[model samples]
Target: MEKYTGKSVLKGIAIGRIYWYRKQEYRVEKVETADSEAEKKRFADALETAKEQLSGLYEETLARVGEDHAMIFDIHKMLLEDGDYLDTVNGVLEEGFNAEYAVETAQNQFAELFASMEDEYMRARAADIRDVSKRVIRILAGIPEDGILADGPVIVAADDLTPSETVKMDKNKILAFVTAKGSSNSHTAILARSMNLPALVSTGISDWEAMDGKIGVVDGFGGEFLVEPEQELLDEMIHRKNQWVADLKALEQLKGKDNVTGDGRRIDVFANIGKVEDADGALEADAGGIGLFRSEFLYLGRDSFPTEEEQFISYKSVLEKMGDKKVVIRTLDIGADKKVDYFHLDEEDNPALGYRAIRICLDRPEIFMTQLRAIFRASAYGRVAIMFPMVVSVSEVKRIKEIVGQVKQDLSAEGHPMGEVELGIMVETPAAALISGDLAKEVDFFSIGTNDLTQYTLAVDRQNQKLEATCDTHHPAILELIRMTVENAHKEGIWAGICGELAADTDLTETFLSMGVDELSVSASSVLKVRKAVRDL
Candidate 1:
């Protein structure tokens, strides 16, 4: 028996045969061609074919994953149409090169350009270029795309999966996925979470060829994979798998039940969502409300800022879906790790500590007001609360309230009806937690964002995997901050909640209940488990 361990992002057990998957490689030879015009024409035909295929794939992906993920394919299409990319290909063909050779050369040049960037996000775009290039070259060389043609369920093992390939995978035939390389934030991991597929990454597997057709068990919960396991181990794994499924069934029954502790303490179990589409999942999970509706997604991957009406429609849809349930919509938290080209933000050595979130919104009130006006308009439909991100001072809170007042006044002058909306501040910085008493008086409630707070308090970059062990949210310091924030909120006749990953941690559920936390907002999948934890406690 052989055992391997890796990082597990999705928790489940998958037992199946191992299937080694690899993308077909198109060998590019620098063959001289006498007919340059003919080669150019061939390249153009391939481009046309590639465009059509990409458009169809984009639509399919949109139907499967949603617009945010489908945007990657659209970006791929744009890259194919880039002038520089075309010029490079045409230039190579003009130099008496074959169409395949010209396309490959141009793709490598652009890929290297992106791969050399210091920013990790930009560097990852290199894979997109390579994925698109492979498609076009395959068409030029008459090669079929790689995919699973297995007869039965299997665990797909690969070096890595591109966004396109990941989205297009046949879930029915694939029991789970294992990769030799990838991070938790990679497209593969994102898709696995969305699809609820058991997956393992960075397994350091160099001998995948010998493992094909071998039966294996993937323990996603433990981040382990066992190949040709002993009978005793296999029996234990099968028993665990059955228990997991039974637990899921039990969790489904817990929905619609009160989130009450054993001591009769009641708490609100909310959901943290990104897009309007997430409202359905939140509702399915029986969330008490949406504690953090990340409004930044509306501002991302677009050419310009979203108009007031556009934002209103999006917010209203979610609000209307959860009538009478509070929906906390955070204002645009741009800059830092999240950025838009039109914002024209300057590069900073330490963006996390630099201008971001409330800082940017304050400097750009016009943009801030646009979002506030939309939230107010949407409030007319149902319960809507506006929350500000990365706030560290009472002065910033006062200024935000003043701007909101101005927006309401302007909307009233224009004869537009608006509803009453509650204002809240996210306690993410140590300064915010320390001054929670002062800040609590300015808002209706406080939502502790432990993700950022842990980073700021520990002086550890959460993005740095090496320091992940050091950035402990369970540290006594973080718990004290939470305890203090809740105390301050109650003292000021307000409520305190946690809307970070910590809120979903089952082990911490009892601690939060004991701390008198008013609400716990977590991911949709985690809602039932958290509720069960509260009930058990």
Candidate 2:
């Protein structure tokens, strides 16, 4: 084992690796199964079972998280539609192949595409697609995902990783992650960083072939690794590891501390959550409360609208998480995302500007009404902050708020548990940025989703590989947007927070701190680094 010491990004930093595997799963079935109805039937059954198992997981997540998570299964559904995967496999099998042979040939095709991809997001998608393929093979061969995570401690290294893999990771035993193919924005990269697990990815520098278990220290943030580490190196890693734990202890002390800078400037730190239960982390982190509780999660994973009771139960769970802390919940922000499978929105020419966010809420007032009614009903239980997303106009805000007012009145008339809920908007577009001051007047606060703000402003999809270099956060326009929003929010006596990837970046923490952000709603892992940066600044 080699100890590597270098600046590491803190993507998925959690309580030191909870799960470890001494040996990595690298088995590949090499038999060539000929194309036949029997083969297709076997493959279809495997896929169907995977679908059912995944659906169960999906439903469970919805029950715990909310409907917003259902779209992932909708994606799963696409893989099953018309036996799309089966047909693709059959096409390969028709070329005179066995299961192993078919897997190899298709894998080669995928490898070529992965090689040809220029965008990091697109390249990372290859891994997810590969995971899907591998699972299909596993099903056909009767292998299971059982006990995979329980297999003891080792740094899981691969060419790349997917969200499914990272999200499924047993935080209980897994220690760390390393990959040769991914960069920061990849789903796994982001998830690992959020989990507070040390990871190193995009290591085009490391040799995956020769480096099986020799041992290497991974610094996730900056993507550094050392191989065949000496004793001195091991000591340093142990020291840093200890320092990391110590730093966590220190941040916990700041739980109730105001996010104040050296000059007495106060920045609010809130947790971005999807459901009410998600507020637990925010409260535990000693955050002011929830910054953005995307209510869409309630509507997303289920087949239809959640009954008012279901909505009430879900909202109540979050109120309990905060207890006395404030929770800013966003009413269903749908249009732009594939949040509802029934809607099946067509691939838009310009999704950033398409029918999404607050627009969708206004268009479908009933949908928004259910959530607002739930929030008001839950308001008696805890401090609730109500916000809307994709608000580029005052008219949209006015309409949506009016509906909320209606819901509150209706709930009150019905003798429901009604309470005061502050209204807010997500400042995620150039139009919204330009008029944030106006929006500030209408809403209680502004929560910036920079991922979309930057993309909409620059007219560049950050996910597109060709624009990766151009999709920088430091662009003058983006900084100015933050500056203006902060100023506007303050002018209105309303707080402003950032909930995008930028909120989690340690390097930029000082810059945002300097700019006068009221809150930072970032991943869990980033709390320490951001806290450290804030403490220093």
Candidate 3:
């Protein structure tokens, strides 16, 4: 099939052209030299509405164009805090260029700094930040966001895509997405995958000015986007589309049906939930239960820790939602890239390697105990399995057990019911995976959090977009660890489940089944896909 090749030199903003590509459109603007007040007025009007729309994104994730991600916010912070970025952009704007032009110059001025960074994730993050700045400048200069691509199933083109824009998109109109920026690890990938549309990332098509409404086919699995598709290729994709739709319909029948294998092995299919919205997927998909309710959201998106009563209310809602089914809730798996501005952790010289998870819980017993008290208090409504993250040693497991004991004592003293809460820990780190047999003897069950396990074992940072190629779940080392984890856990008479991206790896589900993983806890979207995978296995 013929591909669009001439857009290689044009940027999304420069030359009034978007290097045609397949990617997510965080927002679109044609950056060019505008020399009139009428243009400036148009820019101001767009900025006002853009800010209004972006205001909805001030939550913990700092989602949307404004909130935490607003380029103006970054400049304001820099200007207020005393730095070079704000000064540079201001100086450039004073030189008579439009806001977009000034912002582009400022972005270009930082190119050397970003290029020199050894950390791929940090560098990629800089690119995303610069790209965001261009959009903000365009809005401030009266450049309208490119309208929802020229109709039909449009492949929205952009230099990069943010998570919020990706989530809020009209999924019905977006058949697939291709991005010149962002990587597989970006939440854009997660959201797009959730939308169940095929997408390809990092195609780096920054110059396709004519790509709007142009026919393109994205082979998501192959990470390939073919533009100006040939008739033969179109026919083949049409065939594949029909087959996929038919298969999806068949998979839908599995919803609400028990996941007892043909051999009569009943493996509970549970949803790994983060937000209240996740419950919608769980209930709608008819999950057997909510397996891993990430409690981070309760403490996140706000300025401070939630009160115990507040936490209890959230926990109780989750349990009640599942009705009679089991819901395993992980208590406050904090730290890593997800941060709450108000809940300040001293910027550890090495945040990822320093006080996080059990380390933080141990140091701040009040924080951990309060969360536990809430979970114990909420256990009355339904089955609640309390899981811990990054548990590397049996001693850490024992410490958590002690906290549970203390919380039970405190709640019991208050005449509150302490429902039986099953205890578990994520076996993700190499140490934890290796000692799963011993740890399983102490804990009731084991959850294989492959995301971190892969990182800790391989020493690859998943957040780094540039080196995302290194973050391979299919690597033999990760697969071996998973196999070992399953073996060691069941040997101690405890069940093991997977809760990482690999949990739903249809390519490896049979491999995991062969290794004896008792269950699989996946995102709601993967429930049906993994169901199909399990059947194939």
Top TM-score model: 1
Model 2 TM-score relative to the real fold: 0.67
The C-alpha local distance difference test score for the whole of candidate 2 amounts to 0.67
lDDT of each residue in 203-270, candidate 2, tens digit only: 55445556665666665544567665677866776677777778678777766665666767666666
| 1 versus 3: better TM-score goes to | 1
| lDDT string, candidate 1, 1-537, tens digits | 999998886899989899989776457889999999999899999999999999998999999999998998899999999999999999999999999989889888998898777775677677788889989999999887768878898999999886546545676788888998875545566556544568898788878888889999999999998999999999999999999888788899998899998779999999988778778888998899999898876887543567777788999999999999999998887775654766888898999898889999999999999989888888889988888999999999999989999999998898887777888999999999999999988999999999889989999887564675787779999999999999999999998999987898899988898888999998777889889998998
Using lDDT, give the best candidate's number: 1
Q: Would you list the clashing residue pairs of candidate 1?
A: none
Q: Candidate 3: deviation at residue 104, Å?
A: 28
Cα deviation in Å at residue 6, candidate 2? 14
Choose 1 or 2, whichever is better by TM-score. 1
Candidate 2: 10-residue stretch with minimal lDDT: 14-23
The per-residue C-alpha lDDT of model 3 at residue 268 equals: 61
